[model samples]
Target: MNEKQIEGLLEQHGIKLTANRILIAKVMSTLDYPISMKELETMLLTMDKSSIFRTLSLFKSHHLVHQMEDGNDIVRYELCHSHSEEEDEDIHVHFYCEHCHRTFCLNEISVPQVNLPVGYRQTAVNYMIKGICPDCSHR
Candidate 1:
């Protein structure tokens, strides 16, 4: 995405646009799947780890990004595709390929809704499936 697009997205999510935040958001916009902190750090060598984490935290609070734990217990972050600022439309099942150690977003596969008991609340849901990817299986 271009700087203008990124700026508009951030503004839509009620997040302040800064150089670091814009850079982070731009990098994330180009990714096809969720990314862990380590991988993001590797890609963003110019920025420090804490800065990235801080920006991610802000993004999550503003519903600009989705944060979830993968099969390996590593936290991954992805841009939220929901157009509405009040709702998150990007929630879906994620697949962790054992062979490739990569996480894939199954956008077509909807996450099963959960029925909570009385007085129970659900803030977030993470459904991760672990298996070999198509490439690994083909090989």
Candidate 2:
């Protein structure tokens, strides 16, 4: 996505637009897979690690991004496809490639709803499957 589109997305999520935030969001938008903080830092050479972490933290708080753990226990971030600030519509299963150590969003597969016990509440769900990805399998 372009810078303007990124700005619009941040605004939609009620996040204040900054050059660093827009740059981070822009990089995230260009990638199809979820990225870790270290990977993002490598891509965003102009920004410091702390600044990126802060931006990601802000993004997570606003629900503009989904923070998830890959099978290897590394945290990854992906843009939330939902348009509403109060509701997240893009919840889905994730795939972790053990071969390449990459995280992918399985958008076609939906997360199954679970029945919680009495007095229990559900806020989020993370379902990750680990295996060799298509590219690795083809090798």
Candidate 3:
């Protein structure tokens, strides 16, 4: 997205717009896969590590993005596609490919709804499915 569009989104999510913040958001928008801060650092030509962390912190607070820890044990992030203010803290599925070591959003592969134990409470369900992706499968 352009600066104006990114700025508006940041405002909508009650986040402050900075150059680093906008760049991070833009990279997430461009990718159909989840990415690590390190990956983003390389993608963003002008990013500084500290700035990226701050931007991610703001994004997490506002539900502009979501983080997942795959079996690979890295914290990866992707844009939250839902426009609703609610369910911002809900659990979603993430797909990770071992061969490629890339994570993708499984938006349609939502976590199945089930009853919780009488006294149990749900916070978030982070489910990561690991396998080889199409490209790797072809090799």
lDDT tens digits, residue span 1-139, model 1: 8999999999998888899999999999999899999999999999999999999999988888999998888999999977766668779999999988899999999899989999998888889999999999999
Show the colliding residue pairs in model 3. Answer: none
Clashes of 3: 0
Query: Model 2, which residues run further than 4 Å from truth?
Result: none
Which 10 consecutive residues of model 3 have the lowest summed lDDT?
Answer: 82-91
Cα lDDT of model 2 by residue, 16-105, tens digit: 988999999999999888899999999988899999999999998888888899999889999987897876788899999999887888
How accurate locally is residue 99 in candidate 1, as Cα lDDT from 0 to 100? 89
Worst 10 residues of 1 by lDDT: 81-90
Candidate whose lDDT is highest:
1
- Whole-structure CA lDDT of model 2: 0.90
Give candidate 2's total backbone clashes: 0
Evaluate all candidate structures by whole-model CA lDDT and list the values in order.
0.91, 0.90, 0.78
